[model samples]
Target: MSEIVTTRQQTPGDLQRLDEAPTPAEYLGRMLSDRPALRIGTRTSPMAMAQAGTVQRLLDERAGVASEIVGISTSGDQWMGDLSKLGGKGAFLKQIERALVMGHVDIAVHAMKDVPGDVPLAEGTALAAYLPREDVHDVLVVREGSKYRSLDEMPPGTRIGTSAVRRKAQLLKHRPDLHVDRLRGNVNSRIAKLDAEAQFEAIVLNASGLRRTGLEHRATEVLSTDIMCPPVGSGVVGVQCRTADTAIAEALRLLDDPMTRTLITAERTMLHGLQGHCNSPIAGHATMTGDGQLSLKGMVFTREGGKFAYAQEWDAPDRAAELGAYVAAVLLRKGARGIIDGIPH
Candidate 1:
């Protein structure tokens, strides 16, 4: 089993200053030239590569910097069995993060949803920036020959596939008569199963992921958050670097989206407060209202979807963490802890 770790380091003062350069672009270009092309560590998945490309593009646009993608075969991607057996979602990031610690990569690009909220970041690493968010909705993708076009259209005992415990609980809660089974593999393989005469009438997936894979056309319907509350940290790509890498941090800061940061912060804070495991069916979503207030909703469910707790709250955007904590406390008061503890990992 790979462990999630990175080197703890301290930044040494550079004698150079921004004012020393003729312009901001020139300054950044000079700074970038001080080292080899920036190395971005990522998984080998199409989605992961797409995210890494996005970072590279942003760097070129914002700081006149070039980058190289360092694809890593993470233990999570290599493991074909259940992720829970490997101690949950952390399996996906441990090796890639370790690469950063070993100086093989300067930055790590992660689909924020794949990151585990229950644990702090690997030692010596920090989440420096969040790319602007994409649509966070989960969508239904029906098999080509299936009779069902929507969850409501499906008759009793209709089969749906998804490996996420979050989706399973939510689906059962919404339509208990429909059979929800675990579907494994990446988006391409999962869809191949559906098109390869598998038993699933439909499979649920994230809209942004579909878009990233250029498979959005395969989606049958976009589900509302009310029906399928997104998991925490959905629809965002996070940039992570060594904690002491001041130059890297400064460069990544240029790509940060403050609004996305606030939304993800609130959602992730609530998730961490729940102390959820991989099998814990927890869902959360946060949004900025028209008037600039932050609204957060959180949920917890039992494995069978027979028991659950939910809470929503509002606060100022700057109080994102406070709002998340408040919603988490409310849900706990509503028995979210018992529901969370009752599930098997």
Candidate 2:
């Protein structure tokens, strides 16, 4: 992968300033002078294509630039087994990032939740901007003719299909008698399986994915955050690009939602601090209050759902990382470390 290119000329004073210092508008203005047509790399899934289309529309409206979509097949797209065994969520991003690094594409559009907390990126490539977030909650999709309105309403030993360890743990924690089975595939595939296969009574899925794919009508119940804490970065779509490609970066910046960025940064920071991967039974959700303060809630559970830790913290929006770390520290002190360590990579 190509390394990130830094276009800024660093001076002694610039080196002394904090890294968080804002870039001068003059610099951004100069970069915006040329709106280069961009090629965005994305997975071939319908939902992924829809997300890329969203980015394409935003670029047309905000940056007045034309763009083409490039469909890239990722390891996660082909893998039929467990995601963790294939290297967690990073599997979904590797080929897309490769396309950016190789100059085949100018930007990579992805679901933020599919991004691993600490995966290394090409030196010059970074997440440039986050689109406005969608509903950050999980939903239950029951088979047709099922009378269940919620997980609690299901009968004991009801087979629930979901691939996420966090969802598995949370479901078992609340209903020990429910049967949790691994359900793999894209959003449409999972729903099809739930409807056509008699083995599964219901399945759990992210609300954002369903909404993005126009399948929200299939959701039988939208689980509250209190009932099921969302994964870090859920509901947010992000654009990644070479840092040195200031034109693309500035163009994508037009789509950045400040509050969403702050909240996702905090949640991802907490996940990073805990060294949690996609398969780890870890959950976090961050939200901004009307007054601009941020609150973060995090949870960690054992593989068997026998032990768990939970913590929450609040801080200024600018201190999102600090707040995430604080809550992570609290959870670790409460034995979250043991829970995380016991999970297989």
By lDDT, who's the top model here?
1
Which whole-number lDDT from 0 to 100 does residue 278 have in model 1?
A: 93
Give the Cα-based TM-score of candidate 2 against the true structure. Answer: 0.89
Model 1 / residue 229 / CA error / Å? 0.2
Report the number of backbone clashes for model 2: 3
> Which lDDT tens digits does candidate 2 get at residues 252-293?
887888888899889988988898766689899998878878
The TM-score obtained by model 1 is 0.92
Q: Give the alpha-carbon lDDT of every model.
A: 0.90, 0.87
Candidate 2: regions farther than 4 A off: 1-36
TM for every model, in the order presented, reads 0.92, 0.89
Q: Give per-model CA RMSD.
A: 10.6, 10.1
- Model 1: how far is 201 from its true place, Å? 1.0
How do the residues 21-131 of candidate 1 rate in per-residue lDDT, one tens digit apiece? 456655767777778999999999888899999999999888788899999988888887889998788988998889998898999999999899887888999999999
